[model samples]
Target: MPTITTTDGTEIFYKDWGTGQPVVFSHGWPLNGDAWDNQLKLVADNGLRGIAHDRRGHGRSTQTYVGNHMDTYADDLAALIEKLDLRDIILVGHSTGGGEVARYLGRHGSERVAKAVLLGAVPPIMLQSDTNPEGTPLEAFDGIRNGVLADRSQFYKDLSVAFYGANREGSNISDGTREAFWLWSMQVGVAAAYDCVKQFSESDFHDDLAKIDVPVLVVHGDDDQIVPIAAAALKTAEIVKDATLKVYEGAPHGIVGSSYEQRFNADLLAFAKS
Candidate 1:
């Protein structure tokens, strides 16, 4: 029910709970602050203020027709932090949210931030090029765009399976988890979701990663199907000076709130306390 109006007048919905040093969360693409519910409750229960905001055009935030790129996403986050006058905050981001954190620190600086965490995040770069040939192909992103344009609901449902590793063999993912992912995905505006596909896939965070000077915890699932660990956390950890890398052997992309939630919560709490 709480909201912050960005400079552009976009109403960004947020959830702030408990009291202590703040641990701010940024959700992934096509998802909202609710995606961090488990982590937020965990941090709040442990005597920390947990805050998460729905990016513009996602969830309860104003579904604007423009400003769906990473710069705007990062600016929106900065606006939230400044409006709340939050300091000594630990910023944590997952999937696309990770990119947001990186850009925020890069564009806005780390004057008020204490630490940062990136879980199954897309950063450094995710698209293949002459210099970064291991990145995902542009055509793959095109396929996602086409799918969303065709039947957004079905596309989200199908993506949820892979997003949480439900489609993988021997995966113990539950039906509810997949259902939640689909519901969150559907809450995103059609145009915003489509534009984010390009933003997350094409945006390069090389400079952003380099700009981060605070302690960073880079956690990734080796078996991640959505944003492959090789192109994301691995490179990210290497780029950020003195970053701690924690790899979950068989965990999938949605490790933040799925079966791996316990492990993530523990790591996040430990880092926030450290």
Candidate 2:
């Protein structure tokens, strides 16, 4: 596996393909860089460099006992960009990965970033509170923590139903897709998976969204059961100065699935070229 050693000595595995302007992908929780395979291949074939990394404690990356928070997640992203000398980059993140992109711009600035794309991302906060009525209930995340700590294998398998809207009536999500989600999730370190539950749910990204100076494309499914469109993508687009919000009607959180792959890839290529 091609890897880069962070300052903390964690080995970050990455897949780099094609040439031309760089497009860096940050995948969702539990799943690693492999989650972005569909998008990566599309970008690479369209004359752009596609790079996705297995975040520490996930996939091929070393399992970490410390630094499982969002700050460290964003910092690791910065380290990758710096090490590769990638410039004018387009940052694409999905689910928890979206939070990473927002935090990265806020903490590290967008000196090398040309644009960003957030797909079914968690941002502008996911915790329900007095101020944010549309946010997810605290109990929901508690259930996730309990699931991971108790029985992640079965929990991940069950969670894929909502992750890709497989439970929806007239849905076309294949068993392979759901199975792949479980397989990818099982590769994650148990402790790291537990820590990430809080990272994705509690971390506020308002300041991060406000600081993004590059063009941002925010995509979310109106029917997303994981990260509600109203709380995540809608709120994020409203906060970012140059955000373009795109809501996929009747779509689920995992828009990168086979059902949505073609359309998602097309939209991504258009945005990257724009």
State the C-alpha lDDT per candidate.
Answer: 0.92, 0.92
Can you list the residue pairs that collide in candidate 2? none
Flag regions of model 1 displaced more than 4 Å.
256-259
Give per-residue CA lDDT, model 2, range 1-274, as digits (tens): 7999999999999999999999999999989999888778888899999999998899999899898999999999999999999999999999999999999999999999999999999999999999999999999999999999888999999999999898889898889889999999999999899999999999999999999999999998888999999899988988999999888888898855554767788889999998
State candidate 2's TM-score: 0.98
The alpha-carbon deviation from the true structure for residue 40 of candidate 1, after best TM-score superposition, in angstroms, is 0.7
**How many pairs of residues collide in each model?**
0, 0
Clashing pairs in 1: none
Candidate whose lDDT is highest: 2
